[model samples]
Target: MSYRELIFTVPAEIAEPLGDALLELGALSVTVEDAAAGGYDENPLYGEPGLSPEVQAWDRSAVTALFNPEIDHSGEANFIPELLASLKESDFHLAQPSEKIVEEQDWVRLTQSQFAPIQIGKRIWVVPSWHEKPTDPNAICLAVDPGLAFGTGSHPTTHLCLLWLEQNGDLENKSLLDYGCGSGILAIAAAKLGCNPVVGTDIDPQAMVAARSNAEINHTLIQFILPNEDAPELAADTKYDIVMANILANPLQVLAPALVNKMRVGGRIVLSGVLARQADEVIATYSQWLKLSVWQESEGWVCLHGELLSAISNEQSNPSHIESIATPQKKRLKLVLLSLFFLVLLVFAEHLSRNSLLPTLATRIDGTSSPIAVSAFSLLQKTDEILCRSLRCINRSVSDFTAWKINSASLAQESSGEPLKIPANQSKLQVEIQNRLAIPVLFPYLELTLTDAEESEIKTIQFSPQEWLPISWQDSHPLFLLRGAPSGESIHSELAFVMPQNTAGYRVRIFYSH
Candidate 1:
């Protein structure tokens, strides 16, 4: 028998979900790896250390999934196409993935061969259950399975943390807390090294389970709990002699106050999973309660060590500063308001994308955008008959709506009717606008949005046909002036306007005004 493997390469944001989607579609197994692994761009993901993941850090990720041909399904020959169709229904737009056939083999043994006894620092060694412990009696083997959680003493981030623990020699009776204790590797090693009352905490429940199991295999008495646990020893009032955290930079800064609060005065703190360049910022973030310095550097990653010599102000350590789902009334109110603001923007974006509305270009502008605003406000106050005569009217039915829509539009520097001057910052907007309906309709308004290099809105302006249409063209087509562009007729016109300062991009949309 043989297994079918399908592989896909996609952006980092889509990798994890794609893997899970494959699993839900009956894949036997799925694996995700950096698409650029071993290259200069490998795993170039970085975020300020914090609780949430920074998926934007990496450019691309590779995902591979295996399927058993014998599993009940449609035709085996058409299995891949059918699976892809199911994936599309689940909102994953993907191309045909690369495929391969794997003959049956001892997968478990093959996987076990990849993980061997890895000795870290002087006294600690990470040994998979399938491998024997090191011969050295001093070697403290942590029975952690590779990939069971996140850490297994192989990655540089994990290795650096282990080495730091080893150098701390004689931790007997000293309390240590392993923040984000994946697989409980650090907590178990600290326990064996004589640390009393070792504790580990992670947000992921699965990590908590894997960590507890690993601690038991190592025969270490480590208290493993989730961040939300009510364990008395990990209450708000509880503090540790030493605090260690190995997470990305973004989360580190975000959790600075909480992590620092976990340490007793004068207690040491160790932070790993930080890039070399982000050291200063991380140090600055924790400077309020402690002084952190680079303890060691390996493979562009650094382990930070610090001593908390002073107490943080009550305001700095307030519950608001810490991450929690239980937010204060005021904060929740602010969150609701923020959500509403974004919702309004989304509704407008759709309307703006499909159609546009504007009053008119100001008759005069001597280096000022005030006239555009003035004209717009004036149009709003105008009588209904006047407004309809100046701009297009909305409120068309379904079939009529589709028939009358903005076609294509473009914005560029003015190139005709004599050279344009730079002092005015002028540009020409060309739109192929028309109404396909059998009856004539009012000319639509043109709304232009100017944005900066970062795509942030700088200014917005709307124009009526009389304000933007060329005087020469209006004279050439007498009927268009009286009856709006006329039915089945296309009006390809250039609208010129003064660009706002720092304008780097823009959007042009034409739509009937309600």
Candidate 2:
């Protein structure tokens, strides 16, 4: 869980290059924020937002990259000194180990300790902080506490999907597949909505543990599996009526073809986790196989729902279908040779007619438009051989034969809509959470609590098919000590100890690391 954060200031011209070099050096994640901006002529760290109090007019861009020790250390540190030495008046300092860690306890204390009940699909309650009874008029509730899983429902993307399902009405008896099931919230929701044979798959095993626990809590049946398992065969055998993949754009695009195969001919596929800007490319990837339709848009994100088009079959007639099996076509060399000879003659004649015989206006204009001119031509030139060698890291697989070609012409027009503006930081922080244990973690790992805030209470709440945990954080930590309630509630909300705020210097503990 301990990560080294490389924080430095660099000239704008070299910012991008240095960032890329660092990533190639072994950074796990790189983030660029518009810190204090000032003039480059002011100070060495010009363009950097804040000054060090000692110097007032420092203006430089601060670029920070976080690298995981699990990845590579020697590689990252190898050329650092050389790279920094090249810059004129370059100033760099490494932060102490304690300064880099964002104390989890401090975060826990800042968040107000409370859990609120969230209702999903008429019968599931994603209760986190405390256990509560489900009293909704027409819904069954299952309670669950999902920690570090993706399906918290607070994210606009997840909420949009749940809203879509809710409005779609009962999914009774419809087979469902939750692709990239993070915390297995969608699959569980499908089951609670009356869907049968609910199945979930993820690239992470932690998600499976959470999903299985969630299923048991819900008192419903759901099959969870890893992506590269016998599950594909099972899925093909029992085609699902609904297939939902809420993963990000790149992976979604790569998995589009395989995901399409999991659905019945006319089954519905719901794709979320796509930013508005990236929506078009994602849609185009699967447009040929399915009649992709815009189903819902919320919070600068979109959920595309597509119906499998019957026209897309294993036939050659479909214009969009590209067969993996190659078929060779023989060409008549004699005809090609004859065409090339004639083409050269026409080009030469056209050039002479335009340049030499163009004295008369009428004759020149008429001759300029050649009827037999070749539309396009290219020189078939050869290049010298270059020595090449390949090395494989991590997966150690040989060079893949698969070829990828980008078809720009077919790409949907990029949206010119304005970027959604997120609310500015507020003095008072409020976090509402709903969790189901059965899913994997994605980006934006929960920063559980903030420094100097009262710990959020964990309580059992009612949900469709079962009850789970809901965590809510509010208020400051120094005031209230938190611990599991002695009430022996089905689930304990709030911790039993209070952490003293580290005001002198920052200290962070990896309370939980996946």
Candidate 3:
């Protein structure tokens, strides 16, 4: 089947009336675009949320209407002239009307051909209903088809987000909240990865329906609901372990506070649907409550990942100090005196028992620490274990450790066509680091590994501050002398790897020892 497409360049004032006039004159479909597209006078029209209806169309509009080729006007033996006469009589004049023959094709097959099984990271695959599941038996296949919703894993923004989730492991037992969950792909992926109690919210009722259907097909338990303006609650009195929002930059900025309030302390967030240039703006918006940075980039799109920071995390890291401040003055003094007396008694007992009871008492004190303190101490203790397991280094005491925190960290591949040329045997890896702590500490050493989609380590590289650094401080100090970076500082560093073939992603483990 074929059709005739009638195109007209009309002023914005009459575009709507002209479109209605065309439709009343027996047009199949009408579409509009900017007449000055690709020219200096081009006007870009954006339909942002809360935008007025007047701003939806361009100043100079090009309207195209489709019609069946079989339509005839044999009264005068000419169809174009007769149609023009009719439109002019109806007070809708198209000065110059253009006609073109539009060939028709199998739109269903064509649309289906445009989509295939998209592989995200190693374990996750977004497969359309018509497509076969990936051959990998262990793959977490999501049965999603194109619908009225937005995401289908073909867009670079969604791809970047899926890759982030796959590379960041151990989501088991975590809770997730997916805002603007078009098609609910991210929320379902989290559920498949072992995150329980997953919830997806969207403003569109159709999107909520589609997400629910998709979740049912995937056999993942996900709760899909419309955004409740009155009570926007996830779990009552509970914060989410992971929150994902793959929305545009403006909405992301507007929802920053709401999203932050839903996240537990130290919980992770993944944001996409942002351009590489807009990544900084988005990060700055979320920087107040969440430390966000670009985690990955595909083509020109960027994915930002961050963790929630609050007074709870700070208190958890230093329970004893917090307890001192929170406790009454008299109780604090009594505790100090009791601690001193216990120290004296332990010293005497150690002298008498010849160190037999010293180890037991130390173990008891360590075990009696608060859960947050214990977790922090365990992470600190793992420094020696990590070094011993992978790279060899001297074990140091935790007391020497500075309070420097990893407010934002990102691991991404260098863009192609970088000015710096890499050797034939090496590949480029870029690391973005931000310090959110009040005081700066020495440059922390990092251990980076290039891994394939399957997460198998292909190559391991240990980096210190002395290595090839991109940003330099005015008063740079030696690596051994723990450099002091002022609060809210960022650094970028690049390193060349031994060019591991088939490398899909990277895993970075930072080892900070002062």
- For residues 1-514, what per-residue lDDT tens digits would candidate 2 score against the true structure? 4665655543344556656766765666666443333421122322212312332222234567776555655235544444344332243222111114332245443442444677654545566645567667666565556465678676767876776777777588988888888888778777878888888998888888887888787778899998678756354556778888888877888889888888887789999988787788888999768767678788788998988856345666565544432331223566688789987775445344532221121111112222322122111000000101122212111111111110100001123211111122211111222221111111111222222111222222222111112233213222112221111112222221222232111111111223
Q: Between candidates 2 and 3, name the one with more favorable lDDT.
A: 3
- The alpha-carbon lDDT assigned to residue 513 of candidate 3 equals 47
Model 3, 214-282: lDDT tens digits are 999999998887766444455446589888999887788888877887888889888888889789888
Candidate with top TM-score is 3
Which 10-residue span in candidate 2 carries the lowest summed lDDT?
A: 404-413
List, residue by residue over 1-514, the lDDT tens digit for candidate 1.
Answer: 8888777656566878888899988888898876557743244443343433445323446688988878845227787668777887888766445567789989899989999888887778888898877899777888889765889888888999999989988688989999988888888888888888899999888898899888887888989888776898678778889898997787888888888888898788999988898898889988867788999999999999998886655554576765533456668899999999986775444334322222122111212224555565344334333545665556322212323444445455674432222233677766665565434456666787766645578788898767766677688877654466545566677777876656645555555567
Best by lDDT: 1
Q: Cα RMSD for candidate 1? A: 18.8
Model 2: per-residue Cα lDDT at residue 449: 26
Candidate 3 wrong stretches, greater than 4 Å: 35-44, 51-53, 71-77, 229-236, 311-514
**Model 1 Cα shift for residue 49 (angstroms):** 8.1
Please give each candidate's TM-score. Answer: 0.53, 0.45, 0.57
Whole-model lDDT per candidate: 0.71, 0.51, 0.69
* Candidate RMSDs in order: 18.8, 25.9, 21.3
